[model samples]
Target chain A: MAKGGKTLGEEALQQVARRFAVLGEPMRLRILQSLMDGELPVNSLVEATGGTQTNVSRHLQTLAAAGLVARRREGAQVFYSVADPSIFELCELVCGGIRKSLAAQAGSLR
Target chain B: MAKGGKTLGEEALQQVARRFAVLGEPMRLRILQSLMDGELPVNSLVEATGGTQTNVSRHLQTLAAAGLVARRREGAQVFYSVADPSIFELCELVCGGIRKSLAAQAGSLR
Candidate 1:
């Protein structure tokens, strides 16, 4: 259930899960990280992520399909950028959690 | 690569992806949501999520393994609670992204 006494609709819950699932791929995350500074063409993403053009293109399609990225064309080059900037904050929150979890584990070893 | 020109190790990237993958299941999300209020025993979680005892137990084990939830035993009952509260923030961020995506889709449709 969400705020108040109403339960989150099943569809909404599934959508949220799907969003997480889309972000679960390391290649996708790498592509997003590369685009953090600004929009970059597919070739640039391939170079930045050290991934093949085919692999980077595949992940870019996945991110665009998830609405996490937007694609544009400037002449012959196709560029991708973070459509949802909130993703950076999401990564930050997860990173913070990971840091805390690691700290707890380290403390437990002492 | 992260800020300061240091690239995140492959292991760290995989860990982050794993964390997101663990949250990708709707049933797991449901289990976490049920525990949002506080700790609950397996029986209570089974009821709250409307999942069978065996299923809820399995999800709880997965959650615990991920260090997303903590396990406690008292007398004859084992209880579970959120070990990482930052998950709620993560969910909120994903939910916000979904809402934005949906709104944009709706706007484009109109």
Candidate 2:
């Protein structure tokens, strides 16, 4: 994507930063990773992440607030799925860069 | 990119979170946005960001440490550029999500 046409205003920058902060927690990322398969309920997420239900729920709340995941209710159970597919694209881009940096560092060490 | 094949280990999760944290700061994002066009020296970044040289330099150091931006020294001047083209992709993805969320919120208010 072309990214340099205009400078971001302070408010816009903060909104962007807020999105990054939402994705900055390891536990949150774990929860997000689990949801990538499809919609999953809280219990399944807890099992998938091996995290306490309370902890997983807390992260889910944050992720929902950030619009990274969408939640649905069926009977007494709640299911969550990725709110936007672009999230995975973002993850892939960052992870690809990280892999490249690691490869370069290893090359330098040799 | 697919993101759910295997759960990331703790170390890998931290590495990913660290990348998010690096991008979580508004000032650093501003600095990065400035460099999307081409490499620039510290002084130009200071002007583009309306930030002091010391402040801009400090954020640049943090960005470099995180592998988000790269530095090159020529003669007496140091220039900085986005280390990976994927950085812009990440930004675009997050920004697009934020815009969508905002639009949804606005729609609800109507």
Candidate 3:
């Protein structure tokens, strides 16, 4: 935090905030999640995410731009999957964190 | 993905999407970034995150509810930090993914 005897202050937080903003969209998250199940075609993604083909494609583009998802073209079809395995780790960690909070809350309630 | 030999369909992605939705807020991201810097007191968090005291307080509660953050009280002040170190891993992985994407883009451009 200290910089030139003071602080870099807010911009540091803002940079990280932008990353979160990129991931904040529901459609994008669904696209990432679908990728986790396995590499999926864009049409498959649309059906799996319950989003329109146009919306699903748009979200996939957003996700690809963010580096959360990647696509591979084989012949005429492109399959998309989580760009890095670490994303699964993020999902698991967040899921586990949620479980832990629920347990703590139940304990407090009791 | 399988329900009765086919698929659980879309609900699976929706659950994960909601979780991502909770984490996608910028102020929330800033709060988490501050926690990553280290556990911080509420007043310090307000300063570090550049958010109103009331807003910081509200965001912390939302984070607590999401299980992405936890608070410990020492004396009269509450300190908040990432509930799971895994969140840091998420940040790092996502950041790394971004770097990789940039590198790929550069390579392609070249």
Candidate 4:
């Protein structure tokens, strides 16, 4: 995105930082990873992440507030799915960056 | 890139989370944005980011510790530059994601 070519204003910068902050938690990332395949109910997410129902639900709320995940209700059950497909790409970029950083560190150690 | 296809183990997940958490701070992001073009001395970053020398230096230390920025000592002055070019791409992806999210919200409102 050429958007990176220009400097971001304060508000926009904060928005960007907020998104990163939202994804910074270990449990939050775990929950997102659990939903990588598709949508799942709260119970499934709880099982998939090995988090308690309450903890999973709390993270879901945070993710929903960030607009990174979508929520749906069917009867008494709640289902959640990734609202933004770009999220996977974001994670991919971070992983790639980490790998490069590690490789650089190893090279420096040599 | 394809690394995102596999689930990250606990240690790796924490590392990823740590990277994200480091980027979460507004002041740190500001410092990074200031250095986006090229390397600069501490004084120049202070002027560009409008942060005090102490504040800018602190953020630089955080960025350096995260291995996101590189530091060099030229004579008595310290210079900093982006250690990872992937950082630009990461911010670009994030900006794109935020644009899409805002667009979706606008559509919902319409």
Candidate 5:
């Protein structure tokens, strides 16, 4: 998406950055990763991350707002699961992309 | 990659968070986005995003430290570019994943 005329100014970039900032928290990453498995309850999520209930709940709410994860009321418990696997693809691709770039840089150094 | 026993503790999450934090900046996103267009010089990058030299330089360091971007000196001026396209995949995937997740939630609400 080349902005031949520089269409994507700081404002547009900031919008995307907000989403990235929400994902900046490690607990959020772990939370998102957990959702990768399937929908899981809040208690189970807390146990999975070994994080405080308050912390886990906070991160879940952020991810939910970003559309990265979702929550569902399963009877007495509230299950927090990933919004979808497409996010996984993004994680894998981004990681893969950076790894590949690093390898290429290393190659030039040789 | 199941963390059957919470292999990814809070520490691991912090490491990932730092990386995310670097990407969290708007100027950095624009920088990374421009790098997506193969590779470009620092001046071109600055012009593309309409940001200051100092801001661009600072962001480049953060991105480089995170292994998300790289640089090469072309004679006197330095050319900075994204570490790789895979990072693009991550961006696309993350955005797409979240969009999909949100859509699903909206559906459930209906």
Candidate 6:
């Protein structure tokens, strides 16, 4: 928990960094977007992301390791879904910021 | 602009990943935190982050490239500030998600 007027300790900062690193790959973001609506099997993720099954699985493993997504085993197929909804908020914040920055740059050009 | 019921295109996803990669470093996060209140010169950022001036300046460059922060020249001194306030929101979202994940893991252990 953040204390009032207190700086974040080193450990907390590192944890935040790790989370950002997990989201730093474009393919991973695409996979996450595919899973936004509901859990999806590996093949579905591959189709949605237009990535190979190996590549999608690798990214899914990383996302799961970071606790961004949850994996469930049902018979032979494994489905992945977002374990944390906050990811959408993070993406929206970043995307919105990019839009604002672009608009500012355009304004300055005029 | 995101269309209704449309998925993000590759270019947009790449831009988002670039933004996340810029923020994936703890040192960069620390610099951003220091500048949260207001703009600060390079030396001030170095002191606040306990990082070398060169390293801090390098990270600042990356951040500025990503449009997350902006730099201004004040005579011989250069100051940096969060150009996009959305950064704080993104950090808060990721940090909150991490906290929730940790709590869930702890609960499962009990």
List pairs with backbone clashes in candidate 4.
Answer: none
What digit string (tens of lDDT, one per residue) describes model 1 on residues B34-91? Answer: 8889999999999988999999999999888888999999999999999999998888
In candidate 5, which residue ranges exceed 4 Å CA deviation? A1-12, A101-110, B1-17, B98-110
Docking class of 4: high
Task: Tell me the interface RMSD of every candidate, in Å.
Answer: 1.1, 1.1, 3.5, 0.8, 3.0, 0.8
> Per-prediction DockQ, in order?
0.74, 0.72, 0.36, 0.83, 0.52, 0.86
Q: In candidate 3, which residue ranges exceed 4 Å CA deviation?
A: A1-16, A71-81, B1-15, B37-39, B71-78
What TM-score does chain B get in every candidate? 0.91, 0.88, 0.74, 0.92, 0.80, 0.93
DockQ of structure 4: 0.83
Rank by DockQ (best first) = 6, 4, 1, 2, 5, 3
lDDT, residue A54, candidate 1: 92
lDDT by residue (B1-110, candidate 2, tens digit) is 23352556678779889999889988899999899799999999999999999999999999988887889998888999988778877877887888788777688689
Error of 1 at B60 (Å): 1.5
The residue-level lDDT of candidate 5 at A30 comes to 85
Error of 6 at A59 (Å): 0.9
After TM-score superposition, what is the CA distance of residue B47 in candidate 3 from its true location, in Å? Answer: 2.0
List TM-scores for all candidates, in order. 0.91, 0.85, 0.72, 0.94, 0.77, 0.95
- Per-residue alpha-carbon lDDT of candidate 6 for residues A30-61, written as tens digits (9 for 90 to 100): 99999988999999999988999999999999
Stretches off by above 4 angstroms in model 6 are none
lDDT of 2 by residue, A20-60 (tens): 98899888899898887899999999999999999999999
Model 1 CA deviation exceeding 4 Å by range: A1-7, B1-7
lDDT (0 to 1) per candidate = 0.88, 0.86, 0.69, 0.89, 0.71, 0.88
Residue-level lDDT tens digits of model 4 in B1-110? 43446788888889889898898888888988888889999999999989999989999998998999998999999999999887778788888888888988899899
The numbered model that scores best in DockQ is 6
Rank the candidate models, highest lDDT first.
Answer: 4, 6, 1, 2, 5, 3
